[model samples]
Target: MWRRRAAVGVPLQEGKRVLSLLDDDGRGSHLFLLNVAQAGEAGLVGTVLAVEAAAHGHGDAPRFECKVSFDRRGTGWRQSSTFGVRSTNLSGGLPADGFAFVAPNPPPAAASVTITLFDISSGEPGSALRPVLPRSRRSRTRLSATTTAAAAVLLR
Candidate 1:
């Protein structure tokens, strides 16, 4: 059976955070921190963060790593990138003050990837942003595409 794996990261400290990712076999995935969390911060609790996902080839070695960062335009935290089969850290604590996530390499072609800035305090992960969100982006993009296609059809 083809199965999909997922991971959720919660910042326990400034640089340190806990990653709870699921393996394809439905086992507990590996967890570590390149940079330990700092003390006296909001941590992952109720904080906005990003998420990324990717798939490389098939069996092992090409694991997915999610990197989080604050959005551009001084907006909010959002998923910056996803790299295949590499170690990463949420450096600088989810990219405050208009920061970005830097990926070491390009992701796989068949990889499913996304970055989400979520506020867990709302009882829903990735559900507190206003003005713009991933869904909004999709909706707006689809709308624009539809409008363009309609106009083209009418012109034809």
Candidate 2:
């Protein structure tokens, strides 16, 4: 099963927030408002959000989420996913053929999501997954941080 957490009504005021995943056994994923909608339960398209291994889990398990948006009239299908993979795996575990939902257009409004991996084994998030719930909300944006970078990062 997949573990998901979300952040809505994000202030698109030009900044960043850090989404930390403290585990690998699970992952955090999101769908753009538009992408979540359906035009008859067919998903309207046959595309999947491409989640790079780098966007899956950190360390050996890589934990991350995919973001997408849907639109009324069913004209949009945008897709975007984020996660991290084990630093040792140059291939990122997931094959290059992997795919996910893509948002065709920018969100009509301000919204963001963050999924956290919980240790089903411990009935809570694992050691790698920390800062559970009420995800961090910052006013600054920064580039993706590699394993070498600090655990904290800014999101936009």
Counting clashing residue pairs in each candidate, in order, gives 8, 47
Which residues of candidate 2, in runs, are more than 4 Å off? 1-20, 24-88, 91-94, 110-156
For model 1, how does the per-residue alpha-carbon lDDT over 1-156 read when each residue is reduced to its tens digit? 212212222222234333332232333334432233322332222122223233222332423333343332334333444333233234433433222233212222232222322222234222222111245443543222211111000000
State model 1's lDDT. Answer: 0.27
What is residue 143's positional error in candidate 2, in angstroms? 23
Model 2 Cα lDDT, one tens digit per residue, 32-125: 1111223243322212222333443332343322323333334443334443221222244433333333232233444332232223333343
TM-score of candidate 1 on Cα atoms, chains taken together: 0.27
Candidate models: Cα lDDT each: 0.27, 0.30
